[model samples]
Target: MEYRVLGKTGLRVSSIGMGGIPLQRVSEEEAERIVNLALDQGINFFDSARGYTDSEAKFGLVFRHRRNEAIIATKSMERTREGILQEVEDSLKALQVDYIDLYQLHNVKSLAILEQVLGPEGALRGLQEAKAQGKIRYIGITGHVAEVLEKAITLGEFETVQFPFNAVELGPTEKIIPLAQAHDVGMIVMKPVAGGAIPDKNLALRFLMDYPVASIIPGMDSEDQVLENAAIGRHFVPLNEEETKRLQESIKELGNTFCRRCEYCMPCPQGINIPMVFLLDGYWQRYGLKDWAQERYLAMKVLADECIECGTCASRCPYGLEIPRLIAQVHRRLGRN
Candidate 1:
């Protein structure tokens, strides 16, 4: 596979890495097969999160033996020093690895949240401590909001920055990508296929390869997906004129229907997490993880069924999506409604 130096960290990683979200849908044996196949195909970077239930352990099963051949990365949502410290220890135990190659501040969604993490007793202190103690090699940050990520990177502490950048969700182009390139920070793209919303997988991945990114991590659950994504890295094909046109067609079809998870349409007077509900629905409808998605949807503090049809979220949505309608659709499929 073609490799690039993850900016600032100086770690060479595959152009297309393995995302750990979909692993939650597979069995232990199947997860083992999928992960090992990825490694055999020369996909060395594997990213997981403390919140993606057992995803770290599933990776640990294979990484334990192939530790030297893999670059393991994970993240936590904790904002405090103690919380992040405890989360890091838990991550190490779950991954069955002594030290993580990269540990990120998971989804720093807002400017306030970013400030909390960078403050005196924030998670940055915990990550700094872990780096000093040889528990983690480098620190990074991941989120959906370009403005928030842009603000966080200006502090000059993060070694890398990850966010959703794909054919449809093109918000990062406004400032996030330029800022990261200017600062020499590694750019790790999370939703390369727009959370499976993009129909043509190869076309979607090829679209991302055109950008100056360290890696485009597309989550894989089956062997076929692992090979398909790995082949793009191994063979390294750029999207031709026809292929680019096809990708653009798909992106146009999605239009505003795709939720970019920018979180501007938040604080639903009803307390509903608008983007999160759509995210879980994407897992069910696009990723074919109905049961897993439903489980997570039910676990949420506020669900889609709680929407009161105030139209406030829809008004705030920059994309002009019919928030209440989409919420109802997701609720029917994944919620108690």
Candidate 2:
């Protein structure tokens, strides 16, 4: 696979790395196979998070046997020095590794949280302490807001920045990419396929390869996905004129009303699976899989109709999407009523 230097960290990583989110959906054996297959295909960068349930533990199972072959990166939502230090220890224990390659402050989506993390007793201090103690090699930040990330990178504290950057979500290109390039901070891209909203995975990934990103991590849980994504990196071809036009057409069709499934709008007080509802709704409305989508929607224990319009999810969403209204729409399309 094609390898690129992760900005100023100087670590060479595969252009097509694996994201850890979908690993939570697979069994331990399946996760092991998928991760091992990715490594065999020359994908060396693996990113996980403390909040992705057992994702860290699943990756640890594979990294323990082949630690040297992979560059492990994980993040925590904890914003304080004490909490982040504990998170670092927990990540090490979960990953079965002595030192983490990169540890990021998860989802610093606001200037206020950014300021808090950079404060005297914030998570940055914890990461600094971890770096000094050899607990982690480099510090990074992840979030969905371009302005927030733009500000965080200017402080010169983080070595890398990660956020959603797909054909449909082009907000990062407005300023984050240019400023990150200026600061020499590594650019790790998440949701390269728009969280499965983009049908042409190869086209979407190739589009991102056109930029100066360190890695484009597409979440994979199956072996076929591993091979497909890895092949794109190995061949490394730019989009032709016709292919570019096709991608543009796809983007125009997608518009900006869809959810990217970043899960920032989560933990609905009513226990609604907000992203899943939107995902199924996408399948029904966009993909014309009404029966299929409706079946899954019916199976959900906490349906979109359960949403109480508390607006908690909307408040947390980085995109400022009207989540309650969207959930109600999903119920109209998929609910039994």
What C-alpha lDDT do the candidate models reach, one value each? 0.92, 0.91
TM-score of each: 0.95, 0.82
Candidate 1 at 16: error in angstroms? 0.7
Which ten-residue region of model 2 has the weakest summed lDDT?
283-292
- Candidate 2: clashing pairs of residues: none
The sequence of per-residue lDDT tens digits that candidate 2 reaches over residues 1-337 is: 9999998999999999999987877899999999999999999999999988799999999999999999999999999999999999999999999999999999897799999999999999999999999999999999987778999889899999999899987888889999999999999999888767788999999999999999999988899999999999999999999999999998777654678666778778888988789878875775455776888899999988777788899889876678899889889988979
Using lDDT, give the best candidate's number: 1
lDDT of 2 at 91: 100
Name the runs in model 1 displaced over 4 angstroms: 299-301
Residues 1-337 of candidate 1 have per-residue lDDT tens digits of 9999899899999999999988988999999999999999999999999989999999999988999999999999999999999999999999998999999999998899998999999999999999999999999999988888998778899999999998888888889888998998999999888888889989988888888999989999999989889999988778989999998998888877778887889889999999999998998998887888899899999888888899999999998789999889989998765
